[model samples]
Target: MDDYEAIRSGILETFERAVDAAGRDGAEATRRSLAEARDILAADRLRPVVLGEFKAGKSSLLNALLDDTGEPPLLPEAEEIATSVAASVSYGDQETIEILRDTDDGTPGLRVDRRGLREHGTEHGNPENRRGVLSVHIRTPSPLLRPGLTLVDTPGLGGPYLGHNAATLAALPGADAVMLVLDSSQPVLRSHLETVRRAASAVSATDTPGALFFVLTKTDLGGYGEVLADTRAKLAGALGRPAAEITVVPVSARAHRDFLAHGDEEDRAAGNLAGLTDALWAALCHRGVPRVLGGALDSLDRGVRALLAPLEGQTEALEDGTRRTVGELRRRALEHQARLAELRKGRAQRRVALRRRIDTVQEELRRDAEERHARIWDRFESHYLEEDAYLTDPQRLVAQLTADAAQVVGEINARAGTATAAVLVRTAAETGLAMGSSRPTEMAAPTSGDLVVRGRLGEKHRSGRLKRRLRDLSFGGSMGTTTGALIGSVVPGLGTAVGAAVGGLVGMAAGWASAGRDLRNEDRRLDRSSLRTQLQPLKRRQAAHISASVKDICEEFREQAEQEMEERIEQEREANQRLVAALKDTEDLTTATAGTRLAELRERTRPLQELRTRTAELEARTQAFTAAAVDRTAGGGAAGARKPEPVTVPGAAGDISWAEDRT
Candidate 1:
């Protein structure tokens, strides 16, 4: 661990030097890339999340893992469940729990305590969570959680609350590892299996497999061994891997709770908590830290190499021009011209690659927009048909749809922009390396802030006499001219059977023409058909608009990247031209002066040589760390089966102990 930190610090210091070098050379793109990579390295942590179905002992599992045994599980649990808010627990010097909630004032976040957490975040007091609870953060002093390990307790999936499922899914992609908790009494509930599958898929999609494990809770119940075996067999079969490949840590939270209550060594041992704790400690210090550190090192190596490329190349060029004669100057000029030609050729090839990449990004945006819109429409249709109570708030439907549209737009922009930006960064590096010059600015692709659907659709169109008559007919002649006028363009009548579909009102002017009074039987059928007809065109229009706008935005983003690359290439060409001109102007010189100038150039290049050596060392260390992490990942699951060796911290006097009682 100390070795990793030392290497990390050394790389970061070298990265800062590279950034400064790039900046001095006016290499804006390279500097930005280095800065971003530095921030990523500096902010990284080992995040292992606990996920499962509601009341599957997720909170209890977290408490036990953290060695917290207060009554009712240190984290909140529910007898009568409601909303499931996620909670993040980590090690701190002093114990503290804070609820992240919204307030009337437009501040960043609000912090509350255990009672506030129970009232606002738990399923009991604020089951609806109308106050908009974001997450509950808890900190405790536990040796097991040292050196920046964050344990997340996410809301249960496959439950009645869809919001909880969404929250869990949203947070899954960022988890370093997943600990899926299951109820042993229920033989691996389908929901638990589904959660595991999702975690596996998510981690696999990110190309990080073997990052998921299982924990069966309530092992104190009858048939614990049977449930564990059944779970292991099912998981192996489902995942298409060997049973031994999957780690299953069975423990009764109740036993740990009891042990905490009584402080009995036998009870703690009986709970089988020590085994899981040892496994987790092994995973955390060995597998998790290396992965995080290795990724940071990889980024650092890439950034530093790119930053130093121009200086290295220029140093090589200067050393090659050490002869002091007209022929030597002519030869240097010819070489400069040849290098410039090569740079131009490379730039042209990179431009073609950039264009192809942007084309892929554009296609992705179009497909994503269509699929997202279709999914939102499906949900709206389901809710509108199945839940009559949902019809009470037309404004809520509009808000929901609007939010969905915004999310789709935001995601599309973010993904496409990131792809485009990466291409630009690579192009910048290639151009800089070719030109023997450097740059450090980032060309950020434009976002979808202006491209997304905004403002209420109701305000776009107005209705007059035709709307009033349709309102009167649909409302059984109860709405007079005055009420119709007051209702305005949107929501022309209260009881018009518009039913709050798709932005509160859809073609109120055409309702009566398509339906008779009472809107029953065949008339109701015609009314539904007409509403679909009217809404279908509008939906298609919105969808088409979003698609076109996204395409345009993607085009603009691609164009910006192309422009930045072209500018860099131009600058490089100009700089090369000046260097060739200087060589031509200096046609003849004495050997002594030439040798002195060459000596000065060599001195200037010394830092570049040093940087090259430093980067090589960085790469070597990064590869070592990455290879170690891979080995640990391959054998981490089975680390528990063998009698564990005492793992010692670098500076600490005592070995890290998982069996030590925290209570």
Candidate 2:
């Protein structure tokens, strides 16, 4: 067995023993904790979700990586089609296929053959997933899947179907790692960068680093070395990471398949499949496994301490010779009640502070968004009025305006979400609440009709026409008279006829110039008016969008924070109640009987003490395994190892302080 398997087995065994001891002793609370720990371990799998734009070779890459023996590709790969449903591949003794459908209809997963995948998982066959398929699960005995790793093939982002993008995003939270596939021949688009940013945000909620990397596919077409380098640089810049720190592996799936069939060294060299595989394994070993192990150990330690705390309290109470009277128990109960009251007051104050901070942040975000919008609007106005290019083509003008607005709105939402998250984290840290990770709500860009500008340019204005006519008549009469007099002085005979003709021509020329000038001016005025008419509504819609988005984020944050605080308070109340009951129970006992009770308590607590010792040892071993795994994989450019933070696990009796205390 590998180190991960060994460590995982050791931890699982420890939890099993704890569960058995707790069950034997009728320790319900301890068993619950043990069950929670076991659940975490049981659900542990390294999930590297593959994401990319449509036709980026995501499927081909997965196929080549999983199937190297020139067998039919495991995943469906088509040049003209895209994946419609998410697919998860894991290890199994026999190949199995199951289709998970929406549970709203009380539909359980339906097991099917290989042909079912094509029917349900592909866009051509599913046609926007009319069958309500949630995801497709495939289990096979691929060596890559043997190490407790699940490869999730999600629908390509930036596809024609909006639901596909949503599906890909929804699959990100459960991911241990995210592999972004990029086409080596194509330059990275704005969509790719935006998707990466969103993915990064989703991954951050889990606090997993070194879990996102890039895979440049389609290298068999050749002359993509520069494209690969450029993509890496662009991605690195977008992510704010050093170029060298970014991991970008180039591979040719076709070459890999050919190499597998012909056993050619050149094809194998061209494929570079080994490089990608190594990266995946390194990610799993150094980051994914260690994270799961650390979390399991933390949970186990918390459970053990919780179990031991009550036993220690009982043992101490029983060993004491002095049996408390009912009056003393009543006093202690009153003290506990007062403490609970104080806690409630403190919690109320903290919540109020948090809300106020959220309000301030919200206001700041609104102001920032307004300011950004104003600047962008000014630029859009200038571009529309000063540049004849956009004025002539309304479609291009509207597109530009829409893009600008979306960009600004997206930025505002991103900032608001970040600020709100920070406030939540700060509040939780200060108030000692166990806050769970929540996915940030994504804001959709405004695509409604309110933003569409519709009006033909050069529409005649009545006032402009009147003004032009008057100006033309005035210029024509004056110029005609002046020209006639000048020609009459220049020549003696035939002056009248010549002068009249020249005068008429000059008048017509002046009239035409005036009319043209007036029409151009009127057209520009109308263009600006049309833009303003559409822009006002666009601004309002954008503001409302921002407001609603920020409000949702704040509300989510508030709800989660309040829930955590309530849970903690409830735990404290329960602990206090338990204390009161214990004291009251002790009040019924006599001093002579206390000796026997103490002996019994010691016997009951002995097993708990042993369990705690075993839990501690397991925690230490898990930590060591994590450290060693990280160190061993460090040469592969994996992130450096860091010690896990000490988590405060609340107990039923009271707050039990258990630190990692790594020495």
* CA lDDT scores, all candidates in order: 0.57, 0.66
TM-score of 1: 0.60
lDDT per residue for candidate 2 within 530-562, as digits (tens), equals 767756766677667766766776666676667
Off by more than 4 A, model 1: 1-10, 20-33, 44-47, 67-74, 78-85, 88-103, 136-151, 159-162, 220-223, 240-245, 251-299, 306-356, 365-615, 626-663
Give the RMSD in angstroms, all C-alphas superposed, for model 2.
Answer: 9.2
Per-residue lDDT value at 321 in model 1: 58
CA lDDT, candidate 2, residue 33: 55
Model 2 is weakest, by summed lDDT over 10 consecutive residues, at 654-663
The count of residue-pair clashes in candidate 2 stands at 0
Clashing pairs in 1: 27-438, 27-439, 27-440, 28-439, 28-440, 28-441, 29-440, 29-441, 30-440, 31-440
Number of backbone-clashing residue pairs for each candidate, in the order shown: 10, 0
Question: lDDT tens string, model 1, 1-663?
Answer: 344456667767877876786677565765675676667666666788778877787777677767875544567775635354667888789878776666777763656666666677666678667777767787888765655678887777655554465456555545666677788877666545655766675455333345566777887876777777888888877777678667777777778878888988867865767766544543343335544554444444444454444434444444565435445545664675676577667766776776787677678767866886787678667544233332333333343444345445544543454455455546545554322111112212112222232222332233454565566555533333334444544554553333333213333434565453433343334433433443454456557766777667666766666665554445344444544554543335355555665576567557756865786676567445444543453454432222223221110111112111110
Cα displacement (angstroms), candidate 2, residue 316, comes to 4.6
